[model samples]
Target: MLVLFLIATTSSVGFAQIYDLGGMYTYHYRDGRYSDWGDFSLHGSRIAIDELNESGVLGGARIRMTNENTIDYHCWPENAALMAETLMKKGILVLTGAGCSGPAVDIARVAEKYKIPVISNGSNASMLSSAEEFPYFVRVVSPSEQYEGYLINVAAHFGVEEIAYFYTTDAWGLGARDVIHEYTQQRDINIAQEYSYPRDTPYDEIKSYMNKVKQAGIRHIVNTSPTPDTVMIFRALHELEMNEPGYSFYAAEMISADEAPEVVAGSLGYFAPMVELVPSPKLSQFRDALEKRLGKPVDPSSKAFFYGALSYDHMLAVGYAIRDIQDAGESVTSQNMMTYLRRMDFDGTTGHVSLVRGTNDRANMPIQIVNSHGYKDNGTTVDFVSVGRVDPATGELILNEDSIVWPGNVTTPPKQ
Candidate 1:
């Protein structure tokens, strides 16, 4: 029930000079954990609004935001529809942060009905790319299908011929499991194991599954699960002595290493090869202001903040679209927002994002798959280092093999 209204003017703003924005956050418990990532989205959006006000983009018009939190009681459509319908009733069209797919899907459902825009950094569900399905739902994060083809190629570059795809049963996880399987299968990559588990499966149970994969000779694995679940599974692997010199792995790439929680640091599964998503320089400026406000380094590699850049862009895009609506002397309806947003192209805090013509998918920034590793002595500190980057066009991971920090305190890439 935490609603924050961000009125973006300095002072003495007329009633007509303000835009009402909505933030539909998906926050609640999954398994026995509480994740408050909504806090980050709300914070980032406010920062973007403040910057827009400072830059005088509104000319006097301000942005007043009302946040709605859907506790994700059932992880289904009904919850999303209720929250979205509530926001639309308040005359809010530009919304941010439905951090997962199920809620995002339903939010899209309501967005189309109301003609409002639902933007998020965490809504990377492959289906979100369809212009037909979720026309009003836009996301800053690259879609899973867009990245899956690239990720599998990146894995193959690391001499990983035998790989495994493990995921939870949630919408996001199931979507990932199916897509990755298809991508790898098309490439004739040997998916040594396709492990699936319940979303609330215990860590011990997950470890038991890992044991079976270990027996099947899966030296390289790519895990697509919620960060908390990954953290727990990593802990189990460490306890079971399965993480060794020859083992390599990947976690959800959309969550940057810097944004990973402290508990993830010392775990071996959290330390591995990497991928980096680059935003544009203009977007970086906006991102810098927010990072400075948050007392974090603006450098994308700093890892002090992970998803902020993407979410920052979401806010900026909303601001831009709102400003356009005012400038054009048009009513701020969902239809106008979509028309402008679809036609809009600019360098926001994330990078050059163009909503491709006829498709709602973003013509995303070039993604990099890097050969990176981290070694942490404790929960808070990680020797996060990147020795090489994958050429997005060629899928060539040009890595400095000499700098790889292997398990067993070794500092070299596994003999390929």
Candidate 2:
């Protein structure tokens, strides 16, 4: 009887397992303490774990999270190898939540070298999935190239024939501006004007260009920049009273949810590809748990589940791969693990998992537009209209839902 009790106690203790997920958090500008932007990714990972635990998927699993400060200071290629080594030593199988594209690529190189997959929360850059560099990178978020195509489709719907392009000198702006220009050309769309300005340059320049656009009868404006800069552009527009029946602007995902609507008022619209986790029964319960733990409502735009969801899915993939190898009575080597991951299929909260052709290929991503008219600063319902799916054949959107404008799960009351 005593021997049986000992076996039961040992079995209970041995059932629990720990998994480590490598993560990197980048922020805007630079601040020593925790960044609100950084939390956006962390919250994503936390929400994933919370949901997995509740669902009994990770009932006895513990996750050790690590934050790589690539955003604080740009990490070099060598540093990436060092970081990967450290994570590998700790038995980490995945790297998630890289915000900066450059550093994210560095991490990707190291991960691929080590045969560990890096899942990104940052806006998709084709370089991360290119045949040359990317072989182990997977992006949950849709690529920026798709955003340009989406806006083009939406603009056509609104009777916008000509568009003026204004962007920053930053890498994101340059990449997006170039790709969009090419796409617009292919579609036979007329370009009223194209202007690029430095990040620290005056909003006066953007306004000056806007004046030209207005004079030239250009109605649609596409601004590809961060929230701070985007706000300046709109402030300039507001000052000029550029608000008109046909005047509109589309923006990238860099626009912060907190300030995007308030800055633009009801005059502008945003275009980008975002993951829709709202209205999810699993997500709602996770939100409640987060509130109970944090003692405050999770910010709607915090992207609290971004990294969390990616991490949970990453671990789930790893766990299933392990179970498969164990079942086959094969030793779990990196090569064997790759074989399992290559053909692995699992239904995750994020969606289905069927990798694209190459090593860096990820699942299909959807595009949506958020027109923040009735949204407030703290909380607002983001108007998420399904635009299209990312088409692997042409790397463009296969737009079927031409204009299915839908309400977000959370909405701020209209101003009185």
List pairs with backbone clashes in candidate 1: 6-65, 115-334, 258-303, 279-350, 280-350, 280-351, 283-348, 283-349
TM-scores vs. true structure, each candidate: 0.82, 0.71
Candidate 2 residues 273-391, lDDT tens each?
55544355555655565566667766543334443454445545655665676678776565566667656577665566556666444556433454544354334533334444554
lDDT per model vs. reference: 0.63, 0.57
Clashing pairs in 2: 43-304, 44-304, 44-305, 44-306, 44-308, 45-307, 45-308, 381-410, 381-411
Best by TM-score: 1
Q: Give the range of the ten consecutive residues with the poorest summed lDDT in model 1.
A: 1-10
What CA RMSD would you report for each candidate? 6.2, 6.4
What TM value does model 1 have? Answer: 0.82
Candidate 2 deviant stretches above 4 angstroms: 1-17, 27-38, 50-62, 66-92, 100-102, 113-115, 168-175, 197-217, 226-229, 260-262, 277-280, 298-344, 377-416
